[model samples]
Target: MTTGQIAIIVLILLGAGFMLISAIGIVRLPDVFSRMHAAGKASTVGISCLLLGAGFFFLDEFLFYRMIVLIALIFATAPISTTALARAVYNNEPALRRQLRHDEMAGSVAEAISAPPADGDDAILTTPS
Candidate 1:
């Protein structure tokens, strides 16, 4: 086989391996946060490598560009979505929050949780005298 073909195979295999590891992590991990972390980081790399391999296989300009865009979008959004999900889970699940060994968001989360919900009568939206 050609070197290009070999490289594509390697990329695809590596991507599959990463995705498999991510799946294992999600299943084996003790907590929701760890599982989400595994799913977020490993799956991003896995999907990117898979897309790269596909782009190489097709070697079409349009497909190549689309692959690049897909990789970029995954990299851009994965962490953001993961963090948002984690925060949502943490805020909603007290038991999950207790499982955290080191939480940088503890202060902010505590304050947010303790803070009273704002009503529509707040001065921020009202005209000042």
Candidate 2:
């Protein structure tokens, strides 16, 4: 009924909507990469929004700081975890690329790790080859 209550309701609805959409995306997407993109990215946003809404509803200064810190931590580490999971999945299935739209880290990391230039094989000495 009140304005503040209305705002909290709207924020919660938006967050829940994003989470539901992301869940659908994971289930309906054609491939693993697309599913990861949806679930990983959208869920992070949804959770942040939910926390933000809860912060306002709780109406406490300390709680607000805690909410902000939680959101910050989510923003900080989520992408790294998502990338690591994606890379793990990709290593086991090279064919993942065929279904993906545009893979920025397609070959470089894997190639660099799989076969490094040997010291004796390449013989790329600083002084002489």
Candidate 3:
């Protein structure tokens, strides 16, 4: 096999390994936050690597550009979405709060939760007006 072929195989294997680890992490983690952390980080990397390998294997300009765009999108959005999901889950679930070792957003979350409604309605709105 050519060197390019070998490199593609190696990258694919590495990507698959990362994805497998992500799956294991989702199953083994104690809480939703930890599982989201594992899935988000690992899946982003794994998918990027897999796309990179496919680009190399195809060796086409169009595919390479597409792969780069996809990788960039994943890198840009994954963490933000993960953090948002974690924050929402953290705020909604009281049980999960006890499992946290350190919560940097604790003050803000508590303030948001406890603050009275601006519109004098019973339902509190977390979103800024």
- TM-score of every prediction relative to native: 0.81, 0.78, 0.82
Q: Write one digit per residue (lDDT tens) for candidate 2, span 64-117.
A: 999999999999999998988886666556566545566665545445345534
* Model 3 worst lDDT window (10 residues): 120-129
> Model 1 reaches what TM-score against the true structure?
0.81
Best by TM-score: 3
lDDT of 2 at 121: 38
**Which RMSD values do the candidates have, in order?**
7.5, 7.3, 4.6
Sort all candidates by lDDT, best to worst: 3, 1, 2
- Which ranges of candidate 1 are over 4 A from the true structure? 113-129
Model 3: pairs clashing at backbone N, Cα or C within 3 Å:
none
Summed over model 2, clashes come to: 0
Per-residue lDDT for 93 in model 1? 68
Clash list (residue pairs), candidate 1: none
lDDT measured at residue 61 in model 3 versus the true structure, 0 to 100:
100
Judged by lDDT against the true structure, how good is candidate 3?
Answer: 0.81
Consecutive 10-residue window with the lowest summed lDDT within model 2: 120-129
RMSD after Cα superposition, model 1: 7.5
lDDT (0-100) at residue 16 of candidate 1? 100
